[model samples]
Target chain A: MKWDFTSVFANTDALLAGAAGTLRIFAICLVLGLSLGLVVGLGRYARTWWFYLPATAFVEFFRNTPVLVQILWFYFALPMLLPFEISPLMAASLGISLNSAAFSAEIYRAGIQSIDRGQWDGARALGMRWAQAMRRIVLPQAIKRMLPALTNRAIEIFKMTTLASAVAYVELLQQGKLIASLNYNPIEAYTAVAVIFLVFLWPLVQFTYVLERRLKRDE
Target chain B: MAYQWDFTPVLANAPLLAQGLLNTLKVTGTSLVFGLALGLALALLRLSSRRTFAWPAGLVIEVFRTTPPLVQLFWFFFALPLLVGIEMTAFMAAVVTFSIQSAAFFAEVFRGGIVSIERGQWDGARAIGMNHGQALRRIVLPQAVKRMIPAFMERAIELMKTTTLVATISYADLLFAANEIAQKTFRPLETFTVAALIYFVVIFAFSLVARQFERRLAVSGESTVR
Candidate 1:
C-alpha cells in the first residue's frame, strides 16, 4: 500500500467526536484531582501524623512511579479487589485522577507553605476559625502561587491521557491507532492526533504565559 | 475463581525481575547521556546569534515539550520506520524516542542555566579571545553546570518513569514484565505494585546520589566562585 498522509482526516466528524471524548476525560479528571489533592495537601501541611504519614506515602508512591502502572492496576486489578463492576473509562479517570492528585497535593502543600505567617495571624485576629481562615484567606492566596505549577501539571495530565490507550479507552491516541489500523497510514493518523493535541495545547500555553504575567503584575 | 495477590508468582520470577531492573537502568543511563548531549546542542542553537537557527530550535522544543511522550514513542516505533524506511528494535526505539523527546525539556532547563551565567563571565571569556564554543565549554558551562545539577536529577527521575511508556510498544521494561505477569495470572494488582516499587527504588537511589552530587558540586562551585 502506498503511504497516504491525508487519510486519517477522511472523516472530520469522527475526529471531532474523539476530541470531545478526550476533553471530557480531561475535565472529569481535573475536578476529581483537585478535590482529592486538597485533602492530601492539607494533610501534608498540617503535619498531623495520621494524615501526614498516609499522605506522604500516597504522594511518594504515585509521584515516584509511573502513571501507566497506576492505570493498568486500576483497570485490571482494582475492581477484583472490590465487589462492583466499573467501566474502562471510569477506571481510567480514577487512576489518572488519583495519580494527578498526588502531584497536586505536593504542589498545594508547597504553595500553602510558601504563604507568610502574618496572613494566618491576621485571620485569627479577624475572629476566623482555622478552617474558615484557610478557606477564605489561605487557600485563595496559595492557589495564586500554585496556579502556574498547576497549569504545567494540568498540561502534563492532559498529555498523559494519551496513555489511556493502554487500558483500551478510545481517547484521541487510541482513536488515532484505530484509524491507523483501518487505513494503514500511521503517519497521518498519529500526526492528525498530534495536530489535534497541538490545537488544545497551543492556546493553553499562551494562557499560562498570560496568567503568569498577570499574577506577576498583581504581586 | 477469586483473585488476590500472592507473592509467589513475583518471587518465582525474581531473575526476570532483576533483568527488568537492569534494563530500566540501562535505558535511563544511556538516554540521560544522549539526551543531555542533544539537549545541549539544541539549547546552544536556541541561544544562537542567527534568527534562522533560533526559530527552528525553538519550534522543535515546543513540539516535543508540549506533546505527550507516549505519542512520540509510538510515532517513532510505528511511524518513523515507515516514514524514513529504517526499522528499530523495541529497545532501540525506546532509547531513540526518549532521548529525542526529553532533549526538548533538557534543553530548556539547560538554557535557563546558560542564560543566567552572569553576563560578565561571557564578557571575560570573550575578552580572553575564546570563541562561543570555547566560552561555553570552558567558562559558561562549568558555572551553569554547577547550578544545573538539581534540575538534572529531577529530570532523570522523570525520565526513569517515562521508560514505562515504552512497554506500550512491546518493549520488555519493568512495566512490560509486570504486564505479562498480569495477563498470565490475572494479577495486575500485585504485578503493578511490585513494578511501582521497583521504579521507586530506582528513583529513590538516584535521588540520594543526586543529593550527594549536589553537595559536592556546591563545594566545588563555591571554591571556584571565590
Candidate 2:
C-alpha cells in the first residue's frame, strides 16, 4: 500500500488540541507529583518509624504496579470507592501524578542521601535548626544532584500520559487513533504522531543530557 | 455510607485470569530474550567504526526510545498488516512490537555497561591479540554482564508491566481478562482491585528478589576488586 501522509493533515486542529490536552495533564501532574515526592522523600529520610513506614509503603505500591492499570483503576473504580465522580482527565492526572510521585520519591531519597554528612554537621554547627538546615543547606545541593533524574521522571510522566487515551481522554495519541480509524490509514496517521512525539521529546532529552554533564563538571 | 465489596465474580473467573497471566508471562519472556540479543546488537552497531552501520542504528534507537510503546503496538497490530500484506495474531504483534521497542532501551543499558569497563582492560585484551569480537565476547561482556544485571532486571520488570498493553489490541492478557470479567459480572471495582493486587504481588516480589541479587552482586564485585 502506498502511504499517503497527507490524510493526517486533515485533522490538524484536533491534533493540536490533543497536544494541548497532553501538555495540560503533564503540567498538572508535574506540580502535584513533585510536591508529593518531596513529602514522601522527607518522610522516608526522617529517623521516625511512623513517617518512614507509610512513606515506604506508598512508594512501593505505586512503583510496583503498572501505571496503565492504575489509570484504569482510577477511572472505573475510584468513583465506586469515593463519594463523587471524577472526569476522565482528572483520573488520568491523578493516576500519573501518584505513579510519578513514587519514582520521584526514590530520586529524592537518593539525592538526599548523596549529600555529604559533613555538610549536615556544618549546618548544625552553625546553630541552625534541623528544618532550617534541610531547607537552607541540604535541599539546595540535593535538588541540583537530583535534576537529571527528576527530568527523566518528567519525561516518563509525559509518555505515560498517552495511557489517558485508554480512558477516552483525547490526548495526542488518542486523537491520532481517532483520525486513523476515520481515514482507514493508520500508517500515515500514526507515523505523523510518532514524528510529533519525537519532535516534542528530543529537546527535553537533550536538555537532560546537557544538564547532567554540566552538573558533573562542577564536581 | 460505607461501600459494600464483592469478590465472588472475580473469584469465579480465576481460571481465565490464570490463563491470561500465563499469556502475559509468555509474551514478556519471549520478547525479553529476543530483545536482549537485539539490544546488544544495536549497542555494538551504535559503537561501530563504520558510520554506515552506526547512523541508522542511532536513528532507530532514538525513534523507538522516544515514542510511546502503545503507538508502536498499534502500528504493528493495525498498520503493518496493510503495509506488509501479512496478517498477525494480536499476540504476535505484541511480541514483535515489544521486542523492537525494548531493544532501544536495553541497547542503552548494554552500551552503559560496556562503556563502564576500564580503558586498560580493552587495551590489555588488544595487547593479547584478541580481535574486537573476541574481546567483546570473551572478556568485555563477561565483566560487563555483571554490571548490566541490575539494569537488565529492572527492564525485565518494566517489560512485565508493559505486557498489559497487549490488551489494547484485544490480546487476552491479564488486564484484558480482568476487564472482560468485570464487564460481564457488573463488578468492575472488585474485579479490578483483585487484578491490581495480583500485579502488585508479582512485580513487588520480583523487585525484592532483584534488590537482593543486586546487593549480593555489589558485595561480590567489591570483594573481587579487593
Candidate 3:
C-alpha cells in the first residue's frame, strides 16, 4: 500500500552480497568479452574467408539477437545438444561473455577503422607487414581513439548484466524480486535494486563522459 | 551428440506464430507512434529556455535513460498499481514503460539534432519578429526533424529490438512467445533460432525502409556531398 524500505534493505549485508555478485559478473564478463573480442575482431578484419566470414556472421548473430534470448538458448537449450549437461551459471557467464564479444567486436572494428588510411600505407611502404603496422602504428592510436566508446560499451554491458536474472541467476533484479515476493514491498525492493544499479552505473557514466571530452580535446 | 537443426516443429505452429508476430508488430508499432510524440514533447521541453521548464524534464530523461527499461517495467506493472492503488493491465504496463523509454531516447536524439543547427539561423528567425514558438516551429523544427530522420530510424530499430525485453516482465511479445513454445516443445535451439531469424528480418526490413527514407529526404539541391 505504501513505501517500505524496511524489508528490502532489512539489512545492508544481504544487499552487499547481491551487489558483489553483480560486480563479479560485470568484471568477469568484461574481461572475457574483451579478450574474445580482440581475437575475433582481428580475425574478422584479417579478410580470410576461412575465418572472416564466420567471424563476421558470429558477430552479427550475437550483436543483432537479444542478449536475453542468447542467455536463454545457452542455459536451456545448449546443454541438450552438447555431450555433457552444462551448468546454468556457466551458461549464463559464457552467454554474457559471448554476446558482449559480439558487440565488442564492432567496437574493435570501429577502433581499427578509425585509424588513418595513411598509417596503413606508410607501414606497407616500410618493411612492416600488415599485422606489424596494425600492431605498431595503428592499434595504439585506435586504442586511444576507442577508449571512450569502449568505456561507454562497458557501462552499457554492466547495465545489461541485469538481464542475466531472466535465466534465474540471482543478480540484483532477481534479488529484489525475491525480497519483494517475501515482504510484498515491490517499490522499495525495486527502488533499492534500481539504486544499486544507479550507484554502480553512475560513476562509469560520469567517467565515460569525462573520458570522451578528454579524448576529444586530445584530438 | 549434436544439435541438428530442426524447423518442422516450429513451422507446424506457423499460423499460431504468425498471430504472435502480428502482436509483436502491434506492440512495437503502437509504442513507436505514441512514444515519439511524447518524446518530441520532452525534447521541446528540454530545449525550452526557462529554468523551471527544463530541469524537471531533464531529470526525468536522465533517470529513465540510464536505467534498464525492464526494471522500469517491473516498477510500472507491479509497483505502480500497488503504489497508486489501481491496477493496469500487462499490456498497459508494457505500453507505458516502452513509451516512456522511447521518449527519453527520442529527447536525446531530438535534442542532439536541435543543437546541431547553426547560431545564424536562430538569430535570423528571432530577428524576423517571430515569437520563440513560431521561430522554432516554422524555421528551426522542420530542418531539425529532417536532420533527425536518420536518428529516428536508428532509434526505431533499437526500440523494436528492445521490445523483446518486454517479455522479461509478463508481456507476450515474440520472445515471450518463443519462450513458451520452446518450453513446451523443448526446442530451444530451433524455436529461438527461428525467433532470431524473424527478428533479423523485421529489423532488416525496418533498416531498409529507414535508409530509403533517409535517401529520399536527402535534399536534392544539396551542396557538395560532405
lDDT leader: 2
- What TM-score would each prediction reach against the true structure? 0.93, 0.97, 0.92
Model 1: which residue pairs collide? Answer: none
Query: Per-residue alpha-carbon lDDT of model 2 for B94-129, expressed as tens digits?
Result: 999999889999998988888888888899999999
lDDT measured at residue B68 in model 1 versus the true structure, 0 to 100:
85
Task: List A-chain TM-scores for all predictions.
Answer: 0.93, 0.97, 0.92
Assess candidate 2 and give its TM-score to the true structure: 0.97
- Runs in model 1 deviating more than 4 A are A1-3, A214-219, B1-4, B211-226
lDDT of the candidates, in the order given: 0.84, 0.89, 0.80
Relative to the unseen true structure, what is the C-alpha lDDT of residue B207 in candidate 2, on a scale of 0 to 100?
99
lDDT comparison, 1 vs 2, better candidate: 2
Fnat per model, in the order shown? 0.65, 0.69, 0.48
> Scored by Cα lDDT, where does model 2 land?
0.89
DockQ per candidate, 2 decimals? 0.61, 0.81, 0.59
Expressed as tens digits, the lDDT of each residue in A8-91 for candidate 3 is 657566667767777888888899998899888887887779889889888867766667767777877777678877665677
Arrange candidates, best TM-score first: 2, 1, 3
* lDDT string, candidate 3, B1-226, tens digits: 4567777888887766677677778878888998899898998888888879899899888788788777888888878888888878877887898898898988888887778777888899989898878878898777778778877887887778777777877677788888888887878878877887888777777777876877776655321110
**Least well predicted 10-residue stretch by lDDT in candidate 1 chain B:** B217-226
Residue A172 displacement (Å), model 1? 0.6
Indicate the residue-level lDDT of A118 in model 2.
94
Which residues of candidate 3, in runs, are more than 4 Å off?
B1-6, B211-226
